[model samples]
Target: MKTTLQRIGMILFMTGFVFSVCAQEMEVTGTVYDAHDKSPLVGVTVQVKGTQNGTVTDVNGRYRIKVEKGNTLSFSYIGYLVQEIKVNKLHLDVYLKPDKVALEEVVVVAFGTQKKNAVAGSVMRVADQSYYLPSVIFPYPREVNTEEYEAFKENRFLSTIQHPLSTFSLDVDGASYSNIRRMINQGQMPSKDVVRVEEIVNYFSYDYPQPSDGYPVRIVTETAVCPWNKKHNMVHIGVKAKEIPSETLPVSNFVFLLDVSGSMFSANKLPLVKASMKLLVNNLRPKDQVAIVTYAGAAGEVLPSTSASDKQKIMEALDNLQAGGSTAGGAGIQLAYKIAEKNLVKGGNNRVILCTDGDFNVGVSSLTELESLIESKRKSGVFLTVLGYGMGNYKDNKLQTLAQKGNGNHAYIDNLQEANKVLVNEFGGTMYAVAKDVKLQVEFNPNFVNAYRLIGYESRLLNDEDFNDDTKDAGELGAGHTVTALYEIVPVGVDVPVGNVDKLKYQQTKNDVSLPKFADSKELLTVKLRYKEPDKDVSRKLEVPVLANRMNLNASQDFNFAMAAAMFGQLLRNSDFKGDAEYSDVIRLARKGLGNDPNGYRHEFIRLVEAVEQLEK
Candidate 1:
């Protein structure tokens, strides 16, 4: 009996010990600050040493994480020395010192050099009549030639009597908005050609109903008075792709084709890319596989395809990368695609993610050559995603062309928050395609409308004949992706003068046959869409007719917000069609339509508009 009692006492002692150990794994809180000025540093990455668990510091420099009593916590920030400390208590504060070697680099202005430390009080002016603050040392001015953009004509109004059909591919890219934001933040207006109106409009999320039927996509349309031209009507078309849960998504085989060229040496380029890729790697499932391929003067594989379960190995490979040599973008693409094909997963998501500044200057560097190569490889069922980073000599045009032709999406990561938005928050939509070759063709009823013009999508306009051609490639729709398009319309009764054309003497003119009798009815226009399943070659068609019912600008939050976005784009482009639209009008409308901005993107848009207003003044 005494021995039995001793055994019970022993068991109780062990239980207490176990409970004490478990209690030690409690929450840890900390704050990170700059060592020089003791200012709070935002976006500092805080992670438990030797673990995948991590979190970024808040705007106030505060961070909270869970760790054991003896576990070590590591804090890292760009341009700052990394700090690691053992955790004994719940609260910790760390001050990070700026890397002197990195900070001592000369600040290059048009005239002379300034010490990086002295840049805080100096202003530098370039030959283009733009001023910059030298204090933002990371994205230093490049020694290369000024960046170039392709000049393209904007879409013009078309008389419905002459051309009744408007067809184009759906663009889901949002690169231009972020790129323009970078320029504006740098105290300059972006060049006119850099503003892609369609990209700006599609950047924001719209609230549209999901598909009730089994179709992969849904169409939502509304018409309201045009804010720019009150005499005309604005039609908003939203295409919403069905959302699939991440757990149910097919296995992903990703090849991270990173550019380690000399141009990518900037803080915002390679370092930011590495941090961004780490976030993605942390979120990856064990079933997913990743491979790292890097290019400079030449292309080579840094890591073979491996399961995501071994995240430490993947991250070690990424951390070992350093920037140098010239850019061989074409060779990098070939090798990445080859590796992707070799490890392609059947009935799965296979893609090559290209992170670069888009400055390709070595062999086969021309835009045409790269586009051809990407076009050829896209047939292998491996997609591409072009992520542009850095500034100075960024090649937006080349990166955009590659994404367009390579069955992929394009995004510019200007900062770490933007990276989280693209890679973490919108992971499924950015990485998984639900439909490919999605094309839209709208036929306006001449009896109800006199003239009409697509507000954006100038670069995605497709030939009318290409709409039905299955061989023609087009934009892709990812899971839970929302695409918005706007059209300015002139109703038949509106007294607007349109350009007149000479009658064709070779053709007979029949008014009754040309104009549909049903136009006077509720039917305003017919929207026809064609898309193919991700792995299929055959395309499926869906059509829906829009009603002539007119809605007030305040009728729906989506309508108002979408119109505001469109107006903002037009103002930025300095579009000729902008009538009475001003930046103030955009601000007022946007505020009212900002419904449940959980992600704060709408609020960011409002801020962007305010900035542009100040710039305009």
Candidate 2:
């Protein structure tokens, strides 16, 4: 009995010792992040609340510091708002909001600078410091052949571009109405009441030059046998815009003319727009400017011009913008233009960025009225960039016209990544118009080319007469921009899509054997481009050519990349020209042609395409 009691006492003493040792030691660990992008933030200050003991975040925004079990932790960064958290567990997730007054919240406004508080209108600004893969477009769709497609999958090339190449048209529905004029003049005629699809796509991206020094953005361009008409070749081109840092690059005057009409009440409409705007706001720097102008039955500047420095005021204005009443797009445009004119700044970035579901229902609803209104104000030195959001009953037609006549660009935001792509990843190129009144003319050589069809740009084809007219307005290009076009050529011996004359009509045709015969023209297509510096009234010309040949679709990466883009566009619009095009085939070609995906935009596109397919189902 005595021996047993002694053993029990010893056990108690050891147990108590163990407990004391454990109580004396505690671990505090957590992951820190930059509030802007939930990306891990390194170099942040982490300290015990009210105590001097603290540690900085490591490379991955991770930290481990010894502290009392119940000690509160304070997290801080130079440009971010500080945060306090209780240490409940060893592993924790900490997010730090941006500092409201530290670095000026830069908002890109039209032509000037304003404190965030003074700016009026629904404005979204973004600041991203990440990198995305570069988007490389095939010079022409026929660059790819089957052999190259196979080679791309075998690690033959280090990188490749994605699909859905950029397309911009001033008139949304102009593709169907002005084909002949567009082909000659390189300018699509204005449509009365329809939206142009290409303009919507072109509005967001700037024409930044390809990264010449770094890894060249690789792309597979291809031409394939048209599934519906084997007599013609289908060209595909792919593009992927690389991501870079978000910093104090340029100051822009941004007027957000939002459409809050009753038609935009759908879940994806106003709500998505608001969210998108917020994301952009969170990205602003203190040096930028922004304003909010909303149109619903009437147009009003809810917030005056303000600097990005005052975020609270800017955010408050954004929060106050509500959706109601009919859409008075013209009124909104006029007010926005007025605000822009008053705040015009020379040599600085000036642009009004409009966000809408493309639905305009109320006053001055005609496209002509809106276009004329926009055109008159464009001379005031402010440019336009249109962002189309939401779906269903969308008025793409009007938005396209506004962009074309206003000397601007257009884009469609379907998801958050795309929102980032436009607002954060590529802000400068999107908001700053480096070149204006841009036009493209491709003169085909009748000698070498038997027949040819320009795949897209049905609306952008221009008349030769309009080329030199300074009064004629055209598409605008931003800094470092690239423009691509595709032509499906039909050789003399091949049966092409060109219509055949009736046998009876041909029988009556006299075979005139002219004594003077000329050699067949060797030129395939002559591409002539005219553009003006953003602030200039004159135009400059650049010329290139589309060579004639039976291009191996798989032999060239450019060919594959281009075809993929064309097919993707066809899928999006479901064009009447698609005939027998299939999404499955698009996927197959893209998979075989996809090369090094640095930014994952191509991968995301594939997912988007799949999602679209599912929705179709």
* lDDT of all predictions: 0.83, 0.55
lDDT of 1 by residue, 1-617 (tens): 99999999999999999878865787888789999999988667777777645656654677777788888887876568778898888899999998765433444443354554565534332223433434333224335435557777788889786789999999999998898876655444565688888898899888888876798899888888887787889888899999999889999999999999988876567867887798789889999999999999999999999999999999899878888999999999999999999999999999999999999988879988988888999899998899999776778889989999999999999877788888888888899999999999999987788889898888899999999999999999988999999999998888644676576688855343674454355678899999999899999999989877656555478778888888887887788887899999999989888998998999989988886675455
The TM-score measured for candidate 1 stands at 0.81
Q: Name model 1 segments beyond 4 Å from true.
A: 1-145, 509-521, 550-553
Residue-level lDDT for 334 in candidate 1: 94
Mind giving the per-residue lDDT tens digits that candidate 2 earns over 1-617?
A: 99999999999999998777656547777788877889987555566776545555644677666776667787765447778787667788898887655334322232333344454532211111111111110001111111100000100100001110122222222122121111111111112122223322332122233533342121223446654445665443322223333474457777888887766554345545665676677778887788889999888888898987888888778656556798888788889888977887778777787888666667777778887888898888888888876433445556666776788776666434455666666665566655677665545444444555555555455556676676778876554444444555555566444444443544442213533343355544455556676778987665554455645544343344445555655554545555566777666665654566555645544554553343333
Best by lDDT: 1
**lDDT of the structure predicted as candidate 2:** 0.55
